[model samples]
Target: MKTFQEFGLEPKILRAITEMGFEESTPIQEKTIPLAMEGRDLIGQAQTGTGKTAAFGVPLIHKIAIQEERIVALIMCPTRELAIQVAEEIGKLGRFKGIRSLPIYGGQDIVKQIRALKKKPQIIIGTPGRLLDHINRKTIKLDDVQTVVLDEADEMLDMGFMDDIQSILKLVPAERHTMLFSATMPSNIQKLAQQFLRNPEHISVIPKQVSAPLIDQAYIELNERQKFEALSRLIDMESPDLAIIFGRTKRRVDELAEALQKRGYAAEGLHGDLSQNQRDNVMRKFRDGSIDVLVATDVAARGLDVSGVTHVINFDLPQDPESYVHRIGRTGRAGKEGTAWTFVTPREIDHLHLIEKVTRHKINKKPLPSIAEAIEGKQKMTAERILDAMQSDAYGEFKGVAIQLLEQYDSVNLIAAALKLLTGEKKEIEIELTPEEPMRARKKKFDVRSSGRRVGGYGSGGSSGGDRRNDRPGGGYGSSSGSNSRYPRKDGSNYGPRDGSSGSSYRGNSSSEGRSSSPRERDYGSGSRDRSKTTNNS
Candidate 1:
């Protein structure tokens, strides 16, 4: 790793980087910055959290001339969220240089964007649809554009934006600096690069093992009916500070989030159907710790870079191995340890193995947490909180009440009562989720020449070669349910608020005497339980 100073960046840019608390450059930045500074076309292949923004942002900011108050650089992203995110980062990098970057995207007022355009920002970051709309309307000019960047080009292609991208690129001058970045270089992306980029310098920062080394990956096998109870127990036991739960479809995300909230968990859902404002609000709450869990679909969660994410839970398996990698990458970032748990149905074991084969890492199988274990985990958390308060002397005001209780009862029993009060018993509310069809592993062919490596698409079913448009709704590529239907209404009844008046309970557990059976006992009929735990204690 190298410092920003080694790249000979301008003082203002270095100062901004320093103030941003970036001490050393990531692998992508260290390798791409110097070549990009030399004004060469380049192709960078890296996953999302590899600092690709700064890798290109630094040089892009340095080259902009503040005197020329026109759009000299253009960056294209796949979604509105990413467009805004990139624009903000670029804005920060260029703040000291007096350079301006504006984000133009759909779902926002076009009239407002036009007004912002009149401010003469030096850089423009936008999505393909909105950018091309501006270009067609003559609201944006590319005559003076010197640099063009295709961030997440693969995602744009997956969203069926290749033609729009081609139109935008063709309008730019032939003699210009172009950079393309993607996590995977499929055939179409390669062709797009060859046609646009001029002998681009190729740089790859993809690790040999695609999964992050710091992430503890595990999977639990159970029946489809048992997933919700298992998830609730896991959350109670793990007690992650911040967690992301990935679902396969928009409906799944909505239902899962609603169910979590009904269970007294602070959670929200993100998917393509949400308005821009709604999406922004959900993200703000998640980032600010107002919500402890975020339930999201793969496309909706794209390009999301949130810090302090302690866990990633796959409520439903992703459609492909690539998606699994992207989902888990949300955690274990910035050299921090994180945990990922995948719930696999009994029939989906083959698909799980396929993911392991692609990522070249083993995902350990774990037993479903028992209800008693969930209670014990909460007890441990309460004990830790008590210890922390004692160390900080935060319990001084309560000492008199504690002394009174100690005088009335045994100290151990009083302490146990306090823990019980603080850690309320698990609500016996039943939650019934719509069972989704299990994913089947697509049959793959191995190429002997490539050392028996699998060839072609890995269960996503998109064309491996060509410029075909992905016609999936909501710009998502995978097995997501195409329907935009809301959660199904049962018996023509609407669900009540979280007061526990109505809704299903855990059917897999016995409701008699308000006690649930252990998962192993319920599922396997009194088998020897595996009590091993692999969650991060920190």
Candidate 2:
């Protein structure tokens, strides 16, 4: 129940905290802030959504004296995403105090980060890998670092950053305060604390039961490529007023946003590569319903507060349990119920179990709804909308039009037509997502084999149940090992078998396909159908 002001933060920082709309301290913040502010080592065990960033960030910002020395508080994170998120949260909390923070991570330009470091930010937030990179290159100095924080310590251990963390810790002053925050404290994390932390006061904030309590969580067991189609179908069926789709990588976010836009959904992508202004604009659009769907990476979506987000879709399953919890937390706020759907590749089932163990939430297995079912779902939405309009007295203006239309057509026909117009009819969208590297299973050979059979050998490029891999010319290739030669023609050609009267081998070239279609082209088939549906929806 403590407020930011009670935490003894300076007036300017307090003012910024109020402006940022944080009135009361979260459990982790309330317990850890005072101790951290007193310049003591602390360990906080909390999940991602418990507002742990500010728990450590506030005290770090408060204790630091902003100057050109570029040495005050250091935050080390496991991933570039988390590093950027921690830096962003620190930047927000320290805005009025002028206690600047810079994020250092790989995949971004090191020269730019070095140039930013020239600004002499008092706080440095960096991923373990790139922080070490900067230290080795002599671009960053840690001699004056007074406080060190290892955010998501367990994640760093999971990512095999233990050695790098030890090396980084060695570079910092031993007398400085150290804070470690992690969702789970494995033995390695405990060892890390013993080695570096000086009798830290432990604070454990129990993770909120967001997934199972207020949110309905389900998984669609799908192939990597089929995820998008399944997502589109779910969106149609669910008809969520607003939705957030989480993708694993920035590229995935970009492609998903683009593909959703092509399929007539107003969507935008948010990631670390985007400028602050760009991220703000995307969030703004999401809030105002200018964009109904937000496609984002976890780092970019962190700390976002978009209300009325009815659904959270995990286009790709997150790599960690904390991330899964964070992604689903976007919805089901303010005691409202929300739904979350995660698209799980066959190989990542074990990872899903790991997540279930951490979050203590059993996700239900949901079959992918067929296109016809999606249409029915949309029609149901339209039916509800129509009935509500009729009951709410919003049909007064259309009364005369209805009467005139009734004279020309039967009432049932007219009503059906109106419903069709209102409904978002089924559409076939050809989403061409670049295949992601298959997830590597971490299980015993017997476990892997059993799990593989359950998901229909999707990881091994075999069909799931009766869902055969299409053997057409443009049909998908299985894992790189098996080529089209696996389905050889009767004439010993690499391509699938052709007609019985074939003189030469069936040359399944693009030109040959086009020529075959050109002679008596009366049908464009799925391509035209998809395009027509897209145009109608638009």
TM-score of 2: 0.74
**How badly does each model clash, as a count of residue pairs?**
3, 0
lDDT measured at residue 102 in model 2 versus the true structure, 0 to 100: 89
Assess each prediction's global lDDT (C-alpha) against the native. 0.75, 0.70
Which pairs clash (backbone N, Cα, C closer than 3 Å) in model 2?
none
For candidate 1, what is the TM-score?
Answer: 0.58
- lDDT, candidate 2, 423-524, per-residue tens: 754455677775554333223212132343211011223322121124222335333323222222111112222222332122223142232322111111
Candidate 1 on 1-538: residue-level lDDT in tens?
A: 8999999988999998886658799899999999999999999998765688899999999988779887899999875556666876787788898898998764444567789899999899987766765776698989889999999898777655687789899998898999999989999999999999999999999766778999999999987678889999999899888999998877788889989988888999998789989999999999999998999987777668899999999988876676788789899998999999999986578788878876878999999999988888788888888888889976778889978988999998887888999987666777767666555455433434346544322232322222111211222223334332222111011111122333221111123212233211111110111111111100
How does each model score on TM-score? 0.58, 0.74
Please tell me which predicted candidate would have the highest lDDT against the true structure.
Answer: 1
RMSD of each: 15.5, 13.8
- Candidate 1 deviant stretches above 4 angstroms: 19-21, 78-81, 96-98, 105-109, 154-163, 184-191, 219-232, 239-337, 341-370, 382-422, 425-538
- Which candidate achieves the best TM-score against the true structure? 2
